[model samples]
Target: MVVHSISRYLLIILSLFLFSLVIIECKSIKFSTSLSPKSLDLKIEKLTHLHFYLQAIIGGDHPSEVKVAGPNTSFIAFGTLEVEDDNLTVSPDVNSMTIGRAQGILASADQNELAYLNVLIFEFTKGVYANSTLSLLGRNQIDVPNREIPIVGGSGVFRLSRGFAITSRIRFIPNSSVVLVFGCYVLHY
Candidate 1:
């Protein structure tokens, strides 16, 4: 029994000593004030797979659907938004971003509703880019059905984003200037 007790006591002491060493090493780790609260080591690499495919309907002269506000010359225009994923084809599913709306005070008609200053905040589904409304501006849309627009800025996940949008008119109705199908591809970082 004496030998047993001695061995047990030695084992207990060894464990206690190891525990103390662990505690000491843990306390020795000093947090430096110079270190950023956010991990400075956090690497920011562009997510190449991140892409935006949207179909925008520019509201023309529709009594209820399209309302014209602000100055008579520079009217506020609101339109619908539909966003898709990798499939460039605009076949929207339940998971697809849909029923989105975009509104912006139109610039002078002299600018043909295509002005760098004509900005529209487009809202859509999901949390990623939902916090901040993505902003868009018309770049070039003269006689060409294909127009390149600018993504001036964004909010939420897309905050401070800068990119361009290439839009091709899939359909255009000049009768009431009320309908048009545009294929918009927007890429940003």
Candidate 2:
């Protein structure tokens, strides 16, 4: 009988000791300064995609000299965004760097419905020189379908749990006859 009681007490003590240890570990905390106390809200301004396919046939007129421009041509989307009252800085997605023109445009519409626009043009010449056999390669220009557009601005409230909210306006330009389909995912910090 005495041995049984002693064993019971010992078991209780062991359980208590393990429970306290778990509580201590659970109470222990870690700190990081990389986080910001401020809150933010984000929304999508605009997202669009355009597909172009063209085939040039050599039939009636073959000039004495051959001329080749870029392999193909297409326009990209460009736009500006206003986020709430806070100042915003925009950066390029390096992976999006294209061998052809990549355009970014941001536009604003006033009460009168007049649009003011800003344009970013990335014209690449890599494909143009690929086939150098042609005597004359002309400069190629890719323009956005709607060169001018209205601006889109939005806001949403976010807290510590939400981390950062990102709204983006992205466009893709393909310079080939083959159908090119692309999907993009963005992660925010």
Candidate 3:
């Protein structure tokens, strides 16, 4: 009789446990801004892998704001990035292949070292005002050939983007001016 009673108790416990599990599963927390219990699913997608070159002209007279704070200066630079199959120099004009532009600011301790935030705006027929913005925090040492920086967040077309940008010095003109080429690859949703 004792053994039978114990088996009945065990069965009841098992049934109660299962009931509790169902209740918990039904009450799953929804990740959303709404007060309702409805859940919001996240969307996963890939943006274009924009391969372009920034023919940026640095050190005044261009469309950039540069404030020299002794050896470490701060600046805001803007330039054109032409789209091409390979990393070759191109004309900075409104052409059929003209994809976008590189517009941003940079804080530098030296000529080759900087922290920058750049926005790349695509001027394609379909994309129109689509843009990819990036935050680059790194040291572009004079000896280092290139610096790969992070493309953080963005707006318009490039929403919630995360990726990397590469900057390589193409030319250093007279009077501390420079021409830089920036290549960006990003993923957005």
Best by lDDT: 3
Clashing pairs for model 2 are: 41-156, 78-104, 78-105, 79-105, 79-106, 80-106, 107-151
The TM-score leader among the candidates is: 3
Worst 10 residues of 3 by lDDT: 79-88
CA lDDT of each candidate? 0.47, 0.28, 0.49
* Model 2 lDDT per residue over 23-44, tens place: 9988785564453334333333
Query: Given candidate 1, what's the lDDT at residue 18?
Result: 100
* Cα error of candidate 1 at position 178, Å: 5.6
Model 3 earns a TM-score of 0.49
**Candidate 2 vs. true structure, TM-score:** 0.24
lDDT of 3 by residue, 1-189 (tens): 999999999999999999999999888966755543223233566765655444444445553334433332213222212221121233422233544544443433343333333333323222443343444444344335687777766666566667777767666664444455666687775
lDDT at 175, model 2: 32
| Regions more than 4 Å wrong, model 2 | 29-34, 37-189
The clash numbers for all candidates, in the given order, read: 0, 7, 0
Better of 1 and 2 by TM-score: 1
By descending lDDT, how would the candidates be arranged? Answer: 3, 1, 2
Candidate 3 off by > 4 Å = 1-43, 59-65, 71-99, 110-139
Of 1 and 3, the candidate ranking higher by TM-score: 3
